[model samples]
Target: MTEQALLLVNLGSPASTEVADVRRYLNQFLMDPYVVDLPWPLRRLLVSMILIKRPEQSAHAYASIWWPEGSPLVVLSQRLTDAVRPYWTEGPVELAMRYGEPSIEQSLVKLAKQGIKQVTFAPLYPQFADSTTTTAITEARRVIREKRLDLTLSILQPFYDQPEYLDALVDSVRPHLTQASDHLLLSFHGLPERHLHKTDPTGSHCLKTTDCCQRAEGAVLASCYRAQCLQSAAAFAERAGLAAGQWSVSFQSRLGRAKWIEPYTEAHLEELAAQGVKKLLVMCPAFVADCIETLEEIGDRGREQFIAAGGEELQLIPCMNTHDSWVQALVTLCRRAPQAL
Candidate 1:
């Protein structure tokens, strides 16, 4: 029997809070064609323009959330990796970042050197998107081909609606919902609308209407990010005993001017505030690890914005980072994943 390895990958963070480090990270992140989805010249020009002042501002945002140990994203991911390692008796477990250090290339090479021929390439994204899942898988394949590594990959599909994943999410966040709150917001990360259509195999099904996601099925549902997100929220709400009106879904972290899935989170905060929801609870189900987006973007800035808009308070339910349930759920998912090559 051949040894089977597990490699967990996440959206990376800047190596440090320094502007230079942030710039490097952002450059690598935004320059990816899957992320920017533009022609080389156009993407380069757009990214270059963004690099001008975005890095300094981004550095400040990262600094606000920077854990003393290092980036919260990386630190928490490593912790999750550590927690899962003890349970994976078949082979070694490694962690990698999509854009930064301990890259997919480096992780694969390390596994190959250890005589591990089969790897379960798990991208820590609940929802499927070209920018996240596809890009990570693409890079792994690219490295395997370009470098001619002998390792074979068994990729884990997005587990957005997996029972184990939903169980972990509900169990982890149930306590937060029990606290006094007027509304619960399931805030998933935003993606450009074009990305959805570009990925739509049906081409005519996605973004067709306000209720299109509910109607999504078969091939469309499998590839639809919005549908998967809505499904995750619906399943979570059902399990948590949240009434339809008690919780609503919103998309966050919109970038550039391109139309993104909405209602936008920032605007939704004000909407909820205006509706006289005095206390609010927000859960970013899209992310399993609490990173700058969750900590600073939502926990910090979002709280200020919500409070200033007449809401009394906004609580950000933390991600299931290294939670015991999540650890076990992840192990189950990995064990059940389809093995390849």
Candidate 2:
């Protein structure tokens, strides 16, 4: 076996909780063709419109959740890297962001300079999507190709339904379940529904109806983000031994007016409160490490909304960041030989 370096990647955050920094981050994030998927000219126009007022608003949001060290996403990702480094005795471990500094390019360059010949890139997203897992892997391959680096690269498969991943997720939430909670909500990041059609290999299985994603098969599961999210939820609930009605799933952080995957997180929070759920346990499975979305959108504001709507307590479960089981799962995922680019 060749000596290999491990690179962990996650969605990025603004450089700082400032308007200029946030604007710069948004530009890089939104300009990705895979993310917006519109024609270049139209995408640029839409992004420009969004930047006009979004930066100020987004900067505030970032500020509300910003950790004293830095963005929670970046900090927690680094912590995960440190935790996994000891296990990866084969080579060094490094962390990168899909949209900011400590970029994939730089991480790869560092590995190359260390005379590492094999690299296994682990995208921190548990479920696959064009914008998240796909884009991160695509960018890494691009850097290798364009830079002419003499290195072999492998990428992690989405671990949504992987037994180890499911088990780790279950372990992370078991302690929470032991506490008093009326409901458990599994929230994955939202993607436009059209994204499924664009990725579906059969072209006829996605969004045909409410049950289509639930019955996804073969290549469908590989590309169907919603189906993978749902799979994770079902597996988790089963492993945790929760009754059918005790837990449910929802999507969060939707952008644009285009129809996104249904059961929005905020709406579900309101619904749970209305249903007289006094104690709610909200878990973010899409993220291995908590970010602004988990900390602010779900923890801070979500708690406020749930209480205002009529709830006693809304507890945001910490993500599987640096957990012993999660670290083991990462090791096993990275241990696989280079399978697909």
Candidate 3:
């Protein structure tokens, strides 16, 4: 039997709340071409400017949510890794971050040393995006080539429309949905409009019409982040028994001057509140773990904004972090991943 291992990768967090640490982490994260998506010179210049003050503000936000053990993302990811380990059965389970410590390089190297012949590279993003999924895949391939590691990688493709994934999402959040909130906002992390066009295999298929995502089919839909998100949200709503008016979709975490996918979460918050929604429930389907984006960005800042906007309460439904159903679902996904020679 071939010795196999499961490796899970996620978006990394800063080593600490310190300004220097946040700056270092942000620099690595933003410098990736897939992320900033600019010419080398222009990207460097833009990121340099962003580094100056964004770090301090980000550091403060990190400080606000930092766990006693470590960054909540790192901690929660490890917990998920631990929970899934026993089920892998094939071999050991390891967790790595796309950026920062415990990187893909380090994890691959460790697996090689353990005499692992076949490894599954799972980028923990349900929806396919060049920035998150592509960068991680590129990094893993880079390590294999540069370091000459003798490991065969079976990559896990995006599971946006996978039945197991949709089922797990609904099962995990059912508890939160039990309470009747005025509305449920399915908020996914926003992507610049250009990203949608850039990833479209059929360039003319995306963002060309008002309902391109709805009309998209086959390859166009496969590469479309927005289409995949909408699919996931709609599937989850149906499985969770949410009515039409009970739930809506929006995009969050817009950065820079670039236009991102709309019904922006920030604006949507106010819209819901103004429409006499006294109680609002927000779920970040973009992230499987509750990181700063879900915890601080939505839970903390979002809650404040919603209440101030005349809403009585705003509650963030936690991600399916370490939930037994999610763990089982993830293992099933990994087992079904196609192998590469």
Candidate 4:
């Protein structure tokens, strides 16, 4: 067998809660073309303006969620990689962040130095998105290409609707789903409206009508983030035995004032409270691992909002961090036969 390396990638977090560290992290993350999608000059200006004050606010959130071990997202990602590496005797596994210290370049360099020629990049996002999955792949390729290293790379496809992926998702969340809950809100991260339009092949389907995303098929469904997000939610609902009116979907962690897909998670939480829904179960199917968004935003701030608006309990179902099923599902995704690039 050819020597190989498995590179697991995820959206990164600051090394610490220091404001400077958080600011630098945000700069790298937001500067990516796929992420901000603004022209260079305008993007720089906007990001600069954001950096002036947003870092302090972000620092506080990161502080509140900071685990003793480290950032929960980074820690869980490493744990997943550590578990999977032992199973794959054919290759060693390494974790990389597209925008942090243990970065794509750092991981690639170490592997290249070790004579690793073939690499499989498992972008942790279950859904396809230009910002998350696409950016990670592009950065990996850039480092390999720029260094003129001998490397063979393959990527994991979106597993939002895959059976094993869905099964693992259900397996991880099943323990948390309660018959006493009035509704299950499967919240996903938000992307700006333009992103949906940009990825839409027909340029007519996404944002065309509310019904377009509801019908998940064709190229749009395959690549459109909105479609895949919805698909994951629906599949989880079905597999978890959630009946109609017992489950709903919303988008969370939205940034900067552009219109993102709705219903927004915070607003929806308020609405659910007003509608006499008392017990709400919240799960972030979009994120396989828990992070600041899930821990502090949803678990802390979101819970406060819901209760303040007249709801009893808003429990956050933990993400599939190092769950056995999720780890097994990840191995399946990496070891499965490769698809054509």
Candidate 5:
């Protein structure tokens, strides 16, 4: 049997939490056109300014979340790769980062040397975003075009609302969602409002108006992160038997001075606390693995803010990292893709 290779790609982290390494990682990550979406010179100027101060701040954030083993994102991804490898009878499994080390090109090259011709590129993002999924796919294609290798490539479509994924998400958080909590907050990472408007086909697709995204369908709003996020929350809520008033959606991890999609998670927490909500359960469905965003921003700072705002318990449910059900879901998704080459 011709061997196939499954390459799982993720948004990467710096090799270490060192300030210099963090700066380098941020420079490479923020410079991508899909990421910053700014003109080169201006982007460089802006990044350089941010790098000067952001790295030390970022390094501190990372240190708070850094696992004894390594970056939680990298460690968990490797664990997922290991778990799925035994199930894939026809292929080898590899992990790649979209922006840091073990890049897409390097992973493909390694697989090629191992006599693997058929390759499947699985962007680990559950939702499809030009910045996340497209960047990874474009890099893989660029490598293929440049090398003129005999490799064939298959990209995994985003499965944000996949039933298997929903099941896994529900299973991951079900244990923590008792009736005691005042409410459940399904928070996702926010994108700039400009990005949604820039990418929307009809321009009116995302008015940021109430219920606007709830009414959108088809490719008209495919690139709208807000729409996908809402859908994911709805799916999980439905499957988890959450009542309408019991759960809500919010966005987090916003950077810069520009306005981003709302309602913001931090603000929402304050509002909930003010509204007499004492205990809360928070879930970051946008992230498949725990990182600085989840660890420090949400788990630590977020929790602290919630308590300070008059809330009692702010319990953070962990992401489905290397969990058996999630691993099985990922392997099943990969197996369904046609073998390339």
Candidate 6:
């Protein structure tokens, strides 16, 4: 029997919490055209400026979330790979990162050396983003092209609205909803509004209005993170049997000075607190695994901000990391890839 390979990838973390390591990681990450999407000289200047200060601050943020084994994202990714290995009868399962160490190139090389003929690239981003999934695929393609390998490649596009994914998300959060909370906040990582406008084929797909994401009839919803976020929130709410006004969506993790998709998570926390909505439950559906963004930003700082603004009981429902349902969903995804291709 010929061997096939499956590679799972994610937005990577710095190897260590050291400032220099963080700078190097940020440089590689932010330098990707899909990530920054700016011209060379300008992007270079901007990245350099950020590298000087951002790394130190990022290092501190990472330190808080770092596990004794390693970064939570990488560690959980590896665990997921392990959990899914038994389900892949075709061949071995490996993990890689879109940025940082144990890169996609190295993973491909290892599989190539084993004479693998078919490879599936699963860039584990639930939502499609040029900066995330596209960049990983481009780099994997570049590696295959450079090596002149004979491997056939297939990429797992976004599964933000997939039923299995929705089930896994519901399973992850259902238990937490038992507690009393004013509202359920589904916070996704934000992308710049300009990116959405540029990517919109019809030029009017995303008007940043409340009604903009409610368009479920067209194909525009495929690439719209805002729409997907809302849909996931709805699915989770329905599965959890929550009322309509009991939940809302927001975006977080904005970069640069550009305006990103709103209502921003920080701003929403303030608004909710001011509106006398105490005891909130927050969940980040954008990330399948808990990392710095969720652990530090939402769990720590977000909670502090909510409390400081006159709210109480901020609870963060963790991502579906190494959960049986998530691992099973991943197995199902990989198993169906050969048939889909």
lDDT tens digits, residues 109-190, model 5? Answer: 8888887888888998887677898899899888888977678887787788788888988888888986478899998988
Q: Local distance difference test, per candidate?
A: 0.94, 0.90, 0.94, 0.89, 0.87, 0.87
Please give, for residues 1-341, the per-residue lDDT of candidate 4 as tens digits. 78778889999999899999999999999999999999999999999999999999999999998989999999988998888887777788999999886999999999989999888888899998999988998988889889887788877888898888999999998888755788889889999989988999887788787788888587889889988988888888899888878888899988878999888998999999999999998999889889998999999999999999999999999999889899888888888637323
Clashes of 5: 0
lDDT of 6: 0.87
Across 1-341, the per-residue lDDT of candidate 6 in tens digits comes to 77778999999999999999999999999999877888999999999999989999999999988999999999998998899899888898999998886899999989999999888889898887788877898898888889887778877878877888889988878888887779889999999887777667677668756688887435677777677777877887887788988988899998889989889999999999999998999999989899999999999999999999999889999899988899989778766654222
Looking at candidate 2, the ten consecutive residues that score lowest on lDDT are: 332-341
TM-score computed on alpha carbons, candidate 3: 0.99
Q: lDDT, candidate 4, residue 58?
A: 95
Position 29, candidate 6: lDDT: 90
Question: Measured by TM-score, how close is model 5 to the native structure?
Answer: 0.96
For model 3, the superposed segments whose C-alpha errors exceed 4 Å read none
Candidates 3 and 5 compared: the better one by lDDT is: 3
Comparing 1 and 2 by lDDT, which wins?
Answer: 1
> Model 5: which residue pairs collide?
none
- lDDT of candidate 3 over 1-341, digit per residue (tens): 88789999999999999999999999999999999999999999999999999999999999999999999999999999999999999999999999898999999999999999799999999999999999999999999999999989999999999999999999989999999789999999999999999988877888988999999889998899999999999999999998999999999999988999998999999999999999999999989999999999999999999999999999999999999899999999999999864
Give all TM-scores, in the order shown.
0.99, 0.98, 0.99, 0.98, 0.96, 0.96
lDDT of 2 by residue, 1-341 (tens): 77888899998888999999999999999999999999999999999999999999999999998899999889999999999999999888999999987899999988998899888888988888999988998899999899988888777878888888999998887888899789999988999988878999998889988799878988988899999999889988989999999999999998888999889988999999999999999999999998889999999999999999999899999999988999998899888736554
Q: How accurate is candidate 4 locally (lDDT)?
A: 0.89
- Model 2 residue runs over 4 Å out of place are none
Query: For each candidate, how many residue pairs have backbone atoms clashing (under 3 Å)?
Result: 0, 0, 0, 0, 0, 0
